[model samples]
Target: MTQTIAIDNSQKLQLAPLDIPNRLLLGPGPSNAHPAVLEAMNTPPVGHLDPAFLGLMDEIQSLLRYTWQTQNQLTIAVSGTGTAAMEATIANSVEPGDVVLIGVAGYFGNRLVDMAGRYGADVRTITKPWGQVFSLSELRTALETHRPAILALVHAETSTGARQPIDGVGDLCREFGCLLLLDTVTSLGGVPIFLDTWGVDLAYSCSQKGLGCPPGASPFTMSQRAVEKLQQRKTKVANWYLDMNLLGKYWGSDRIYHHTAPINLYYALREALRLLAQEGIENSWQRHQKNVEYLWAGLEDIGLKLHVQQEFRLPTLTTVCIPDGVDGKAIAKILLNDYNIEVGGGLGELAGKVWRVGLMGFNSRTESVDRLLEVLPQVLSK
Candidate 1:
């Protein structure tokens, strides 16, 4: 005879069904997933190893290659957000005592420095003032000085709305016999990128920012050079879960299990990539640029000044200077509370000095720009 377990009545719970405010996301990230992507996410989840799920995984890989314009065999989506992908890049590539050089001009740049150091890299950095980019000559000089095993740079500096030029940096890495890593979190789907042409050995990005998907899965890729470094590492990868050595088999032909994949988030990411491919990556880039430029014009019309040099501004995100005597937090708060619109405040060196406005992914539209402009002036007068 089996005894029935009593239902515990000690725990209090609210019986109300879930509800959340629907605000227009115009901030740094998660700028509104496309409706179709959300619909895909709502589909019932399948077993991680099911044949149908496996087929979808293959499609995601192929679509990622097309989106990044690289034929990297190891491209796969990590089960967490963009930070997981960033950690994966460092874990797979940095061996103990390897000298890793990073370019630091903003928050994400510093994040890479911290991550590389945590993985036992003897990290070195070449930094510029926030809102500036490194010149090829400066990078070459740093490469000569550090002589690191890996050189990492941020393609899109999200904190300061600056675009670091990648054209010749990869060539410098090749000449110095070092692997090139890049943080493309804010630029992947909405900005122009050619990983093969750029010679980036390792790169990672998120699904939320530029792919028009809800945050969860992240895109990561490694080239042959990085793979070779992994193969030659004398020490085991510091991060077991993110180690590409095991993940490769799971994502590759072997189909071995590593961890239980987040089935629904992958569904959303797959759909996001599908829509991006359908739109053509170049066209999507153009859309982000067009909308952001319109936003800039509107902001300037209202007596706002942008923080970054116009030439270095990112098309996906912009840093608008907060006018003198205006409380940046109050403005952002009023916009959210009254207008039901959201804008981001600064981070790191940019804090309290500027407003972080994003025109990324599905939210990069003329309507989005118009709506924000219409509501912003009303809030500012308060």
Candidate 2:
């Protein structure tokens, strides 16, 4: 006979069920999930390996392919946040001692540098100011100097609201016999990206941003060129969970068991993707552009200066310059507490210098822009 141990109850406080406040998320990355996505997430979950769930998995892959405008058969969702998918791309492609060149213009770019270095790659970086983007000629010069095995870049720098132009980068990578890895975490559903056309070899994105879904499963895909590199790597991927060879078996026809999938998150992601497809990706891009322009006009009208140059500005997020003698964090807090509006303060080099405002996914609307513009002037006056 076994005696059960009594659990201590003194430290446990009785609390009400979670009641979250409602706020319009006008910040970087997550910009509020759609109501439909929330409802889909609430649906009862099914077994991860159930036939129905597997079918949903297939649908998700297809939708991701469409969303990314890539036909890579290995496209799949990683069972974690955007960072997990970001790590997956690095782990699968980089081998110890391989020269990896990364573009570092903002916070996330630095994140790639850290992740790549941890994976044992000899990392080289081409840097720019926080709100500036690289030129094609500069990338060509860097490729000539490093001649690296992989070239990684951030298509949209969330921290600085700068969009890196990648139209001719793929050809440059091919010319250098290197693979092109792109971070589309902030640009995926809202920005205009033709992955296959641009010849991007590997890319990753988050569910919560342009996808209009909550933070959980993330989109990841690799081109045949990148897959070949992975297949020929001398050593096994250092991270087992992110090892694509094994993950491929689970996502591919092998259907092998890997980790337990986030069923409800997948449900939400599917609904969000479906809605995006219905809206037509091109239309969504246009919508984001129009709304962001409206937001830019409104912000300028309120005498706020934007951080990024007009040519490099992103449609999804904008970095607003924080005027001298004004507190960016305090304004953000007041907007959250009083106005029920959420905007983000800057990160890294831009810290205390700018405020990050996002018009992404379901929040990219004239109404959202108007609301933020209405409160910003009042807050600044005080």
Please give the lDDT score for candidate 2: 0.95
What Cα-based lDDT does every candidate model obtain?
0.94, 0.95
- Model 1: per-residue lDDT, tens digit, 127-211? 9989999999999999999999999999999899999989988889999999999999999999999999999999999999999
Query: Alpha carbon lDDT of residue 17, candidate 2?
Result: 97
* lDDT, candidate 2, 1-382, per-residue tens: 6769987999999999999999899999677999999999999988888999899999999999999999999999999999999999999999999999999999999999999999999999999989999999999999999999999999999999999999999999999999999999999999999999999999999999999999999999999999999999999999999899999998898899999999999999999999999999999999999999999998999889999999989999999999999989999999999999999999999999999999999999899999998888999999
